[model samples]
Target chain A: MITTRATTRGAAAAVLGSAIALAAGTASAQQPAQSVKLGVVSFLTGPAAGPFGIPARNAAEILIEGLNTGKVPAPYNKVGFGGAKIESKIVDEAGSTAQQVTEYRNLVQRDGVDAIVGYISSGNCLAVTPVAEELKTITVLFDCGTPRIFEEAPRKYVFRATPHATMDSVGAARYIVEKKKNITAYSGINQNYAWGQDSWRDFVLAMKTLAPKATVDKELFPKLFAGEYGAEVSALLTSKSQVIHTSFWNGDLESFIFQSSARGLPQRIPIIMTAGETAVARLGPKMPDGTIIGARGSHGAFFSPDNELNRWFRQAYVDRFGVQPTYPSYHMAQSILGLKAAWEKAAAAKNDARPSVDEVIAAFEGLEFQAPSTTIKMALGKGHQGIGDISYGTYKYNKQKGQPEIVDVVRYPAECVNPPADMTSTAWLEGGMKGAKCK
Target chain B: MTNRSTLIGALAFLVLAAAAPALPPWLISLATIAFAHALVVLGLVIMWRAGLVSFGQALYYAVGAYCVALVSRFTGITDAFVLIVLGGLAAGLLAVLVGFLLARYREIFFAMLSLAMSMILYGVLVKTEALGSTDGFNVAPATFLGYAPEGAMLNLALFWLVLVLSALAAAAIGVYFRSVAGAIAVPVRDNEIRIEFLGLSVNRLIHLKLVIAGILGGVGGALAAMTISHVDPNMAYWTTSGGFVFVTILAGAGSIAAAFVGSFAFEMLRSIAVALLPGAWQLILGSVLLITILFVPDGLGSLFMRKTRGKEGEPA
Candidate 1:
């Protein structure tokens, strides 16, 4: 009984017991009954909600549920923000930018939320940034796609958890050039707004660099929320462009797909959609097979399937919402996880006292974490912007699964698609892949 | 009795302004926007009383907003008074030019024509990159008489400015209502031929009304831009025009106070609807409108006027 093995085993057990007890004591001591209040802004009840916004809101709800209960898997485990429970106030992001601005102020000043998360529209994103700074509230922009947010303005208290739309455009163009051949001509039909115009511009610029031989033709800019594409489809058909692209999302995308599919436009030309993943569930059987699609990043159906985290997230999402997680879901998950990690880091640094806004923001700088879809790196835009690799694939309707699945997937690293930290997107693209790394 | 009513209106204005400091920022901001929108409704009320609804009042609203934005951006002008006046003038000039063609139409044709004119501006705004396209852009912070204010002070200053301007507009409109041209607008609505037979140029009178309404709409829009510090083509969209029309219908074109009351009530109800039932605000608004149309017909204004008539034994 007193042999060397027995003695060493006893000593190890004692050390483990003491360590566990100490950790428990520290956790209990650090976390009071107080909770972290978060204002969750999203298109909860609007036309945008069904496809582009509701999934994200659902993911936020489920993810926060898990976090508050300490059921989230490793790395996101432990109670919310160093053992404090998370309480969220959900606000619907309907109406105009002005309405959003007022709601944002209300959420901060009236609601007294510690932080605010969510904004699907780029216009709303641009509108809230300065106000966020003025109030010095920790704000995380979950899914606004304007690059102008970081560039052309100085930011201190604001951060974007999703890559700008430029990455999506550049990534889509690269996918086309690399995967498809015989793309003789390029054309586009985008919403007539900043997001649409910027997407079209970036795609064109990238295509010129990647596929210079592809002649440009048949460009159309339909008004946002136009709800009809018969005329636009007719123009595209008449032009007969070999390759077609669109940045339509949510209801607009569904309407376009519905209208264009009836006219058999997809079969005639190789159609690529920058934000096609949004409509996958709604247009499942209706969407034709082999339609090239992208999810803005390694999100939606075009994600890393090998990771256990991805598997868990996708399964949980489908089980809860009864639909496959779209890019919006992935984005929402990434933001919450990223925010939890940052808060934990700050809490640990402060010996488990509640972290100040500055402390949290400082902790957020250059933060990196493994997300459900991909590894998100706060690598660009002064560490206020998250960058992740882009994923693209062709839609193939799986009869057995009764859903549209992505096939022939292509992946591009964040560095390849997103501009470097020191350069703006337009400047970086203009420089012709000067420092980009692609494989 | 008229003087007493005016005094009561003044008292209400002072009380609201004084309570602003105690009220929450959200309410104050909401009030500012509601009052600004009230200006648009005031103009709509004028046209509505004449039975000439301009479905594209957003054209002038957007023009006013853009004028404020452009003047500030290009000239570095931050004075609220100067920018607002410039906004009114810019929209007024455009209205004067377009009114010639718009005044020539009536009924559905008039509404459609106005909508078309507004859409043209929307199209132009969407295509123009310098105006930030559909995303639009923000206006600089407004300063009051060379005194810069921030946060609560800024809110207070804007509130006072809006209040003073609104009261002045209401008073002036009240006077105009008592004038011959204003008095004949309703008659023109009843029978244009009769008004013409009375030696009044029906077209000329309508042209004047259009200009007046356009100027009011422009001023409202300019004030809106300052209060919100933003502008977009949505301001000129048909839906925006529809909103003004909706407020006009809900408030009725019975009195000037109705415009303010209706707009304020709409904003308050919207805020409450957004809070209690975020997705079903439109449904609630529709229900209210349906009830109003079925029961009152003349709107909330008619209700107040009814009460006054009941007490006084005649229409106030």
Candidate 2:
């Protein structure tokens, strides 16, 4: 026992010695200046992978490759970030927020990525935002729609290249108020998380201002990624709500649609899924007709603008991946495009030299760029959060085409849907959307 | 632990602390997290020695983490030392309360009950919207002796804090291992009746062990929250508890040093694996565990024993 104890101590000492040696040996590898390296994080191997991560990843792969080879159409056709090859280190964001924070550090410190452009989970975005500011890396958040990130605190390095949840909720409420007159009661079945909670809150608040007579009943917040919703479906069915508002995304969105449709819940009450657009292509005829769906913005199937960038992105994306690029794909594409725009603008100001992190951030702020989903305006969150026209439409599964289609698409201008830069979404909604510029 | 082992542990801590400035920010961050988690594994090792595996160590972990985050957020207490103590106390208090009910149970019952307690915390945290629900709030940056650090300096400071706390916890645990109560853990595991016949309450010993483990787990979570600068309900999830148990098994309960070494190895391996193969890192980790279990049944720590036995001309 004495010998064994001695051995343990000796072994432990040896381990510690080796750890120090290893740390000294593995100094930060020199980053190659030939290509613009980016760390792209998304859920690649979880329940979220099927609907959200995979599509977003696919879009990133094709878009980055297109940028590298300069195969993309004009404006974004500049080869990479001002003539440099685009390289990406794709990471799976399937773990805890702590894990994501660690990976974010690894990307910035060890791998020496120029910028990071991913994160579908709102929790992850929130966690990584402060870390990005600390590391002084240009991070473009593609998806994760929690408005609290910018509202809670101001950020210098972190930029969201998509509208927050407020747009989705307000747009959904506006569409409902305009289309469905004299709606007495509505219910909600959102995921019990930041994204879901904020979406429900904003929608309810917007409804209070827009349609004061509408009352909310039977608000159910099921756990996120709770695949089985037998109880939730039963509750929604019995609630007798004129409309059901939900903001469930990824697998949860599809699962709810399938289970609830099976019980004929959607047939009774029109379901307003603010994040429903991602599931439409996958669900097809399974998605109940007349279900009001929003793509979170004028994105994916709801993106109606016929522009050169959209034409090329849609075609290239379809050719690479068999399925049409969903909302996540569009969001990912727009984020990368936004980064590219900032990188190029910064480089141009420096006479085509590689711009520093601060230089790129300067170019990115309050910058308006054309995305595949129309124009993206850095209007809110002090020009760090992107806002654009958000569109909602009724789901119409075309038996003739054997694909899901969105019809009667109503687009709300960015200023109309999003709060002003100075005001929070809550304050704006409560104040009856004062100073809202609607076209 | 003997004087020599304690000296070696202190030497290890010094080496890590001195080397922190030279290491990259990522490595420093990874080491800080590894050391924090090592504290939790240290607690697990203590329980494992007594043949008591509380699968819900994350209960204390989350409690500690939430206590730090909440206290710091509400009371404007930004000091790392105070928040860590508060975290430890909160978790320790809860452990003392739960220890009474837990002392009577053994083996799977104890594991399950602990797991249930942690899940209860997880459920509550998930339902509580003010705490940010599933998307938990961020932790304010910690201050050391009223001197606040930012950027790389902050990372280095946090690393040092974690290292120092870890060293102190390890030294204290080492002393405890030499105590009469700690020395009887194996006997309690082997024959509880004999331990009871020895005029000592086995239940009380187990309860004491539970409290010690709980405090260590809480301290670990508190440090982790400060280092990561965020706290979420997942800290209390079964997976987090399982991770601590996994490290304890991998490190072995034979030596206190094994906990730190094993945890550091686990974190390093995971970071490298994730970097090398982002898609199949879990597969690589599982393979390593399978190989470790099959070849080194006692754990990575037993490999040292084998070396010592070989030198002493014991049965190969």
Candidate 3:
């Protein structure tokens, strides 16, 4: 009977030990989720890599890690901010509409992500905007050139890091106007999407407004990335356009450059790629010098000696990612910085360590922050998106590095070009280009 | 397989179909997609019943999508019901026209030719800028008999419509399968000489089957376009057709009920895969597909029936 009692005690002790171990495990998880969920949507794997897609991803990754390590202070040190280590979920849209729709649904409904970043294609962003609105999630669009993003008038939750495609074209037009050449018969070989169509329409409008003498010869809107462009190229050659501008990027851009160069189209006419800072260096000897382009902003290249943020951001980017940061990378970095600034403000006002979306939104009202591109001030005076630097520039190849950098970079200020709360950028541009200036 | 049981089952199926709309919204949306596509699967099975396998039903599917894009985008008609009919009619007419060429071929030839036709549509969508090229066109917010489908009401209405269409399709196919004419179609594969000697028009029968399949494919594409409220060029691409083929194979050529179940299962699995491992969802699905094909050649429908039959019969 005594031995039986001892065995019961022994079993109880074993049970108690196992329970303690389980409790300890539950308590002291080494990888506790102080980790905030970040869902990044980019064209990571497919044809969109070289242009806005990869750069956006590179920026998000570098910025996220930096913010996590307390090296960068934007998202972490925001006004009402508490440090939350961000764990990222990345998706690649292989340039397919169905896949993109599926990806957007997954990002919102399943991931339960705190916020979203990076949407490289304008068509993709337009498709996802409804989902974002429906889900009521905060999204920082690193790059999607559609004017429709703002034209449709976004909720307070959605913010864009880049200028509208129309404004991008306006910047390009400004540069073209400065050249002082009678560019007769400008032809456009643009991809048939919101960005390309919007840019073409806006550029023509701006060019007509500024230089009415220039007539558009041929406007070729090809399917974005179908791999064969011989027919389109041949048609363009026969058409009478002194200047030919394209908005193709990544593999499509690479193919076009190689094809056109081989076909001797480059020697005959001026070829301006509206995508100012794609993986231009990767194109190597093929990309000609001085191709006109636009960016999330021109601040990716810190040419000015006075700006400290530019210097620091560029240095930090080079240190973090081996490559000099592209326009989209800088754009994404700026968005995180914007979020951090607002969060810190909210925190300071509430005297609480963590701030919610409403507090952050309040803080974002009329808050100005310096980024690599230019200074962006979020003005809630009109209850619409009033942030971002409308910076544009031209690409010049650095032969030593064999990479292209934005030269003759023109940074458009908020007062000069950003739309008023009452009117869209299109309406504002329509109202006689009044306050619009070139840096 | 018996006539008495088939009639009873069909009647019971009709009675239960009334309760289909009570499920969750996502489930219904997915099921609606399945039911609509199940009609298409029934077409594939009808072809399979005649002893032919097709890998390129996407050709007619593409025709249906392009019809929607053309009518809605160019004409600016927002009536969902009318637009769906228009899409179906457009696809059917095209199919009947293309059927002349397709009916002449058999087996792999028909499959390859159908694929070639889909590729042609893909080319047109990618090359023509007036049609927005490969970016395609978006369906404007639609009105179903003047009722806007923008919210929960839309889902309910769509569910009901899908249910009605599915039942009608089942009844039609069931009646056809039971008919004397339908019985003769089987001999087209098994005893061509006997069928020929019997003075039946073999090519005409094949052509009729193609037309029926084409109509069903068109209806599925139209329903899909309505559900998403967006359409693009890739809808016509061979991959889109491949997905439908995969669904038909996965569900097997059994009861129409299996189509709804299979589509729901596929959607759930895809969603789960997307959630757990966002990057490898496709790979995971592909692997499962391979496994399913190898283990269950008769498809998911056969499994449940076989198991039930085994339990009722004598034990091993």
Candidate 4:
């Protein structure tokens, strides 16, 4: 019975192999016009919905439409991959990481999607990576900013379209050290989660290098979504640090800003926010001027808008959503464009046929392309992660107009902030930032 | 009707196991998650009968899940059965230590204490960098004995295993219900003074109930971790424990069958609510709970019972 089973399995493998070969040959012949199903995962409803998730989901919808209709600007003007249509299935990413895993499996196994995009929570992105690899589905993470996804476990089928948490912290530190040279000491208040913790560590390390004599006056890590910061603000104020760095976003960031600003924390010390761009419009007049902020990279308002891609993307997004595109929108557009570029390249390499997962992944490796926000270089970790520039700017609010805008923007090249392709974030940071290029 | 409950449970088991392969991967996963939660609900059913409601059952759940996760990471043991039992035993051991103190408290004090215990674990997990901090860590795929199933087959195997485990748990607990100690749980609730005067140690009985509930909660958490392939500090959050309590209230804690039925129904309703009204899903669930509490009183389980048989009678 064992021998028979082995022989039957061998025969089945042979049939599967030949079937793949035949399909691969005909797939090109029937190419140039097929539908590539993509599962778009982002938070649709929950506390995270208002700021982080909804914008990304909106961008996914708009970007998918653009790709399908060939409405996007040059270089990404093709109707999906190699002249095929892109049809997407949107899924909510508000629940537990486990729930997202189930959704990922559902997308690949049940719905038969060609790829998966969108995950704002670093936890969700990390949780779905192994499953994505196991399913052999190409997954381009839109936002999730954890470096662990690449350094902890590198896989072929998964790629991060945006910069990790390292860039945000390092860029913020560089801006503080170079631009805000008067500051000799600083304190931080970050959410007590992985993203917050990792950002804090990186910021501290980068600051240690950039300003070795600068002292950390105080540090506080409040629980995630712990809105009240009465005691924390008091501690930060009492510490008398010249700067206060925080990585809070969405409701958490809004609450911290409202609570701390009310108590004159911002007035007392300059605040450095790693993910404060999206909060500017909502915070409006409430957001105090001179608060340093960054959108992880040249995202949101800090992007170079003179380019064709940026102009068209920002216009199309505003026209569709009736609101200005946020940093999440930029990240989502980059992911979709990357996916399209890889699939199209693979298709071209394969003689105009639909490329297999391996072929697409091969095409994606070391692939450099232009995005609406900036030029993305897939030069990290053998092309599994994107390395690009990050911009840090000071918030300037116009109280009369009730608007908040970023000013005095300083851009840090990806090579300077992010670790080299062969090194981990901690390893790179611990090595005193060797071989980093600075402008 | 009481006598026929076993038959009903057996039939349900057969129906589910037989149809599991034909179901979609998502549904199979959904069912697995529902059944895992049902185990916690069953544990709550035991405590409810004794007039005890733990607001921190997530303590045991998280303990179980973390046990499985840690074991798999450290020892590379991926056997689902072994991991589940390890989770149960770990939780049970902790309950034994805590129950000594917990059994003496009642009502809000008991709830608060349990909640505190779970929160303590959540705090520890959130701070532990080796365990991935607040983001937690992914669990390795589980194997069945030496056989490793992948993709759809893996889902099917987990479903069948969960089905078998749930049925066995129900049967075993049903027998325990007929035991003197188990049957006394309700009377202990009705008149603790009278039962204490009747030569029974109230504290001992309560402690027993705690251990039983803890083990069941642990098993549920372990199965969920394996099914979902990820674990985080949220498992020990007060809200996670609140979900278990919600299921128990909806099920009424009358019969073991209510645990499975109510949990499955809850999952179905929640999925529908999430799909139909994304913004108001929580509002919709809250409204449904409000309506059920106001109208049904004793929950959906009471509807299946025949009132003619009076108190302590079997379900229809």
Candidate 1 stretches with Cα past 4 Å from truth are A1-33, A238-240, A262-264, A399-403
Local distance difference test, candidate 4: 0.83
- TM-scores of the candidates are 0.92, 0.95, 0.79, 0.91
TM-score-wise, the better of 1 and 2 is 2
lDDT of 3 by residue, B1-316 (tens): 4565457556755664565555434445555665666766777877776776666677666676667656877788867678778877877887799889988888788788888887787777666656554445555555777777655566557667766777677677777767765666678879777887888888888888888888878877777666555566677778777777787677776555566556655655555555445445677568657755765555666555555556778452
In model 4, pairs of residues that clash are A28-A353
lDDT of 2 by residue, B120-204 (tens): 9999998888888888999999998899999899989989988888888888887898899999999999999999999999999
| Order by lDDT, highest first | 2, 4, 1, 3
Candidate 3 chain A — worst ten consecutive residues by lDDT sum?
A72-81
How would you encode candidate 2's per-residue C-alpha lDDT over A130-205 as one tens digit per residue?
8998988999999988888899999999999899888899999999998899899999999877778888989999
lDDT of 1: 0.83
Root-mean-square deviation of every model = 13.1, 3.2, 8.6, 8.7
Candidate 3 lDDT tens digits, A121-175: 6656665665566556677676666555666554666776455566567766766
Evaluate model 1: give its TM-score. 0.92
Interface Cα RMSD per model, in Å? Answer: 18.1, 3.7, 10.8, 12.2
Model 2: colliding residue pairs: none
RMSD of 1: 13.1
The most accurate candidate by lDDT is 2
